[model samples]
Target: MLYNLFNKVSSMNKFAALTKHFAAAVFWGCMMAVPGWAQSPGGTEKELIRLQNEWATARIKGDVAFLENLYAKEFRITAMNGSVVERDADIAVFASREMKPELITDEDMKVSLYGEVAVVTGRENLKGTYKGIPGEFALRFTNVFVRRDGHWQLVTHHSTEMRKK
Candidate 1:
């Protein structure tokens, strides 16, 4: 009878261990399935910051090729003037001389990440001309990027002109 009780107790302990492991496995599986639950590797934020800087440089230089690769096909921008510009149209304007950007500097940038998506918000100090009309302004901008095919691309951008106090 003692031997039988010992075997039964051992079996119960084994069962409890198995149950614990199974619960852990399930928890991990659920975590992996949920978006942004998994811990991201380091340097993602720095890479995104670099991308933001590159975007400003690309705009000033009218680097169409870089812009093409950076912007997703469905990308859209809500301009400071409240006009919505699609990817192709924006790229065209950048390629042409109509949208001249003498300088664009980003400041006080913040980046938020969610698994495959990231949002960047900052102020852009811009000095340039559009259609020979000189303009200088500060804009508060939000740029959304999505990781696609292992590369980040701008999916949406919205900017509002910052009015002087």
Candidate 2:
């Protein structure tokens, strides 16, 4: 019948309009997600900075346990003296009786985020003593951190002592 055909055609048109609206909603939702994803890196950068400071504080206080928790299991640091410092070695330094940090400060710290990895570069001015040898140095350092299990841990560190100008 003509009336039946008209009703069926109207229903089809209604279904098409609903589909269009649903598609539009999904499209806009995805568009909003992009910006949210982009903004997430900003939070990560701030967190990395905070972690950097905390690491420095732990070093100054000789908090070996804290450093152990923050560092990855395979963490390694190439020191300014060209010594490859592994996790256990560094923890030993923190636990040493002769080496004690008097002042540990960082400056000009910058962090770059690559997905779940963050690279931090900064200047560290340290005043300390190791084995009765004065440890006063200005160094530029790079620290690589990775996010795992919703926590950031330092994976690698390399530092070069900056010569006096």
Candidate 3:
């Protein structure tokens, strides 16, 4: 009788181990099938920051084509003067020789992610030529990004000049 009881307990222990292994396998399988399920909040934030840096680099290089790929179809921007620029116009401005951005830097950025949407707020310090006029400006900017088709796209942007204290 003692041998039989020991055998039963050993069987139960084996079953429990099997159940645990099965549960872990199922969880990992689901994560593999669903792209969103596998991503962590920290990973999302890092990807968003990387995209922002890519955008800044594109601006410095005057690579509007690269920016176009990163922007959404209905992308828009509000200038420091409160003027709204649509997708085509924004690309045009960037493509223009007069809008040369010698230096484009993002500083003190705060990035927040909510599911598929992200908001980034930061200071953009620009040293460039505007219509043959060399000037420098520091602006506080907010850029909104949304995840679509497994990629993040910039949908909206707004900037306001940073005034002297």
Candidate 4:
């Protein structure tokens, strides 16, 4: 009778251990999946910022071709003066010799990611001129990004001057 009781208890212990091991395996499998999900959003955010930085550099370099790839189809832009520009026209504006060899930098940017869409809002400080006209200004700008075919592209931009009285 004592031997029978000992055997039952030992078997129960082994069963419990096996159950614990299976649970642990499942937990880790789930943990690994979380990263792939989280990475998509985080990676998109970082990529959005990187793309903006590259476009900014292209602007500074006056590289129209590089800048062309950065823009999206049907891209819409509103200038600080409230003028609307379409895709190719906007590219023309930038590629035109209006801007001197200058730099465009983004600051105080707040970026939001919504699935396939991202919005970047911030201050754009320009240090350049366009054909004797002051091309640079302290402006508030918002750039919209959309993810297409596994890539984020800039789709819309609006800038408003922050004038001091």
Clash counts for all predictions:
0, 0, 0, 1
Best by TM-score: 1
The alpha-carbon lDDT assigned to residue 105 of candidate 4 equals 83
Q: Highest lDDT among the candidates is held by which one? A: 1
Cα RMSD, model 4: 5.6
Clashing pairs in 3: none
Per-candidate RMSD vs. true structure?
A: 4.0, 5.5, 4.6, 5.6
lDDT per residue, candidate 4, 1-165, as tens digits? Answer: 966865777777868977999999999987786635345666666777788788888877778898677788878888888888898876776778666647688888778877568898888788887777665578898999887776677899999999966
| Per-residue alpha-carbon lDDT of candidate 3 for residues 52-155, written as tens digits (9 for 90 to 100) | 88898887787988888999999999999999999888788778865888888888888888767899999989898888899899999999999888898999
| Model 4 residue 97 CA deviation in Å | 1.9
Stretches > 4 Å off in candidate 2: 1-38
lDDT of 1 by residue, 11-89 (tens): 7797997799999999999878864622543478878999999999999999999999999999999998889999999
Q: Give the TM-scores of the predictions, in the order they appear.
A: 0.79, 0.78, 0.77, 0.72
Scored by CA lDDT, what does every candidate get? 0.91, 0.87, 0.86, 0.79
What pairs collide in candidate 1? none
